[model samples]
Target: MKFKTAFAAAAALTLATAANAQVGPEVGATVYGPEGNTVGTIEAMQDGVVVVNTGTYTAPVPANAFGEGPEGPIVSVTKDQLNAMMAEQEKQMIAARDAALIENATVLTADGVEIGTVTSIDGDNAIVTLEDGPVSLMRDQFATNETGALIVLATKDQLMAALNGGSVEGGEAMEADAE
Candidate 1:
């Protein structure tokens, strides 16, 4: 009984150690850009982007700024090498976005202005049905593109209001869309 207990404990320890050994990108990992420049040391990864310590250049590059490395002394990487690393990261992002699961979401302008909810997206052609009726401030229009993901960024209520030619006011609605 003593031997069996001891064996179980040992087995558990081994399994725990193995699980802990799985490797992931570490804080302070070297980051490179598209042109192989040493961008900085990774500080954090959040919201699908990489934050790095500022050295010669600004940090917090999108996760698309890193790549597999020869794992070495962290601080010695040069600017060009870092750029190369980031280039690799960007390629991966493009590939992943291309293969992203097709689902309905809201669309925003490049400047993050709320546009409309995606009615349907077929390949690069996204049908963004207008949310509000034409607003004087913002144009109600559809966008179509190739090799880009259509992002939806609004709620059904917002869409309905917009379609009815209503405007969002200071924490209230100026005009209500017809029900």
Candidate 2:
């Protein structure tokens, strides 16, 4: 009788552990909409929010919006519903990005070191005027800090080198523009 009870308890514990294995959706995992169509891929988890990248844009949805499905984590909403939500978020993000006033904005490094100033934004790149010269950086490299200052992942030295027609450690020089 005791042996049976111990085995039952152990099985229950194992099942419980398995069920609670993941507290949220796994990053890089595919997320399906209610229609069983792949809507987006999970990019990350921030402050209990699940960030998903739909083909059009990336948006954060509440963690409770997902549930376990046969294939993977599925969103409770339909594809249209999910798209609508993402579209709204995208509009807000675009509005914020547009209002950032990138031109003449001081660009800083991750350590808060000022590197350059943004001279212009061309499509997916930002033209920055560093100490040496002007260098173009991908838009992804530019972000607004907590205080709303434009920040870049590159350091001052890196920006200077790239601006001077020399390749920085993580930046590529514009060969065509160099000549």
Best by lDDT: 2
Model 2 alpha-carbon drift over 4 Å, by segment:
1-10, 13-29, 42-51, 58-65, 102-104, 118-129, 133-142, 152-158, 164-179
* RMSD value for candidate 1: 11.5
TM-score attained by model 1: 0.29
Error of 1 at 145 (Å): 20
Model 1 stretches with alpha carbons more than 4 Å out? 1-75, 101-103, 106-115, 121-124, 133-179
Candidate 1 Cα lDDT to native? 0.49
Candidate 1 lDDT by residue in tens digits, 1-179: 99999999999999987864544346777655444555567777788666666554344455543455455212334666555666676567556544432335555543345565544445554445455332221111222224354432234455455456654333444232222
Local distance difference test values of all predictions, in order: 0.49, 0.74
lDDT: worst 10-residue window of model 2? 170-179
Provide TM-scores for the models. 0.29, 0.56
